[model samples]
Target: MASSTASLISLQSRPSMAVARISTAKPVQGRSFLSFGLRAIPSRRLRVSCAAKTETVNKVCEIVKKQLALAPDVAVTGESKFSALGADSLDTVEIVMGLEEEFDISVEEDSAQNIATVQDAADLIEKLVEQKQKA
Candidate 1:
């Protein structure tokens, strides 16, 4: 009985070690293959659009700063949340209005409510702008 119990523990430990090795090896190999395949593809449009999105985020940061009456030294970035920057609900609404006016894009009420961070606003603005351009 003692021998069987010891053997069972060893069996469990050995399988866990093998599982760890297999899991680590699979992700490394898979990631390398995926990265190589992705690099082989030409993606000019994706690169251009990513640059444009970055510009949009920067613009959103500026607008948020201006709307909140933040001091020049107060840093606003893509991750900056409006509430964290001392903006109340009303201030957020005004910011949305300001963004609409500046971007010349009408944000639906649902979409406006979804703008929590500068990045969220920027992404929403980009999507709205694309839709507007398409129409």
Candidate 2:
């Protein structure tokens, strides 16, 4: 009768061990709350992504300044018009092409035609970068 009780206890203990093994195997299913909390945690990639954005913007600004023949000391706040810098249609085309090449992005002819200010160009470049990433 003692042996029978011992075996029963072992059987019960074995099930608990099996449960622990299963839970460890599938941690998400085992600790659903923990998984939920972990999923909400911010990722390191987010910081890198934001940094890349800042770099891209800075690069775009530099490219624009070079293409527009603007002095290095000049600020590119993105509000200056292409014509304001004495950029004719051909010069603007070259500028747009430079932007596309530097960013590895495409700017539609229609979109390019609509961009009037320096800020508009920067905004467009940023948008293009975001769109490419999503794709």
Candidate 3:
């Protein structure tokens, strides 16, 4: 009898945890409302479209191939590595600079060093563009 009542109370409390209700009080304008009583504010994520990503990759590839002076016979895909494409350190730097000028975004030194493949450069460019738009 007592144990059954305790179990019922626990079950009822569990449902409250599952369902969330917004308070009737309106949140201040231009501010995000917090869910439940959590202290951590959730961050808003920027959504990137597939077409935008593809366009970035194509543009990056074009810059890389042109900067490296690669022949048209050579195919540059996302998986193609900079080294395999005959891009040395200087060429890589030039390519990064070209990307900056084309995308109108600054690339940090650490991030520039991390780009080893076409896909990597494209992904970094996309991220930089997204951050720029958000700011």
Candidate 4:
């Protein structure tokens, strides 16, 4: 019985190495810095309210694309935020201003400070829009 237990422990401790015979491995090309794939990985992204997520993502992407001098059709969908868009402090301020103009609303300097990402801006704007519409 002891020998059987010992055998079981030995089996558990053993590493099973399955050799996969490689046929061909194409080298992955280095991705461009502006590529959206870098930020698509969820662990690297920011979280925001569902109501504002989509619009905010698109707006932020627009800002990034514009800054990078990309054409109008440039895609900026979900998962892209200020950091992923490569926005700096001045750019953030400009983006917030643009958002204000787009939404036709007032975003106070103090209130704007609390915003950290495109999602944050979108959530705030969405709530503000809802409040204004209700009123």
Candidate closest to the true structure, highest lDDT: 3
Question: Which runs in model 2 stand beyond 4 Å of their true positions?
Answer: 1-57
lDDT of 3 by residue, 1-135 (tens): 111111112124343332233333335675544343312223446854333377778888899889998898889987789999888999999999999999999999999999898888988888888999999
Which order, best to worst by TM-score?
Answer: 1, 3, 2, 4
So what's the TM-score on candidate 3? 0.61
Model 4's alpha-carbon lDDT is: 0.59
Model 2 misses residue 132 by how many Å? 1.3
Residue-by-residue lDDT tens digits, candidate 1, 1-135: 111111112124333321111111234534522111111222233322223378889888888999999999999988889999999999999999999999999999998887788888888898889999999
Q: What is the TM-score of each candidate against the true structure?
A: 0.62, 0.53, 0.61, 0.50
Error of 2 at 81 (Å): 1.1
Total clashing residue pairs per candidate?
A: 0, 2, 0, 0
| Whole-model lDDT per candidate | 0.73, 0.65, 0.75, 0.59
Model 1 CA deviation exceeding 4 Å by range: 1-52
| Model 1 TM | 0.62
Candidate 1: minimum summed lDDT over ten consecutive residues — where? Answer: 1-10
Candidate 2, residues 1-135, lDDT tens digits: the string is 111111112124333321111111234534432111111222233211222355655776677779878887877754567788778999889889999998799999999998776667777888888899999
Residue 59's lDDT in candidate 1: 88
- lDDT by residue for model 4 over 1-135, one digit each (tens)? 111111111122323422222222333474322211111111234653655657556765576566556567755554456666566788778877777777877888988887775567777787777778988
- Residue 42 of model 1 has an lDDT of 26
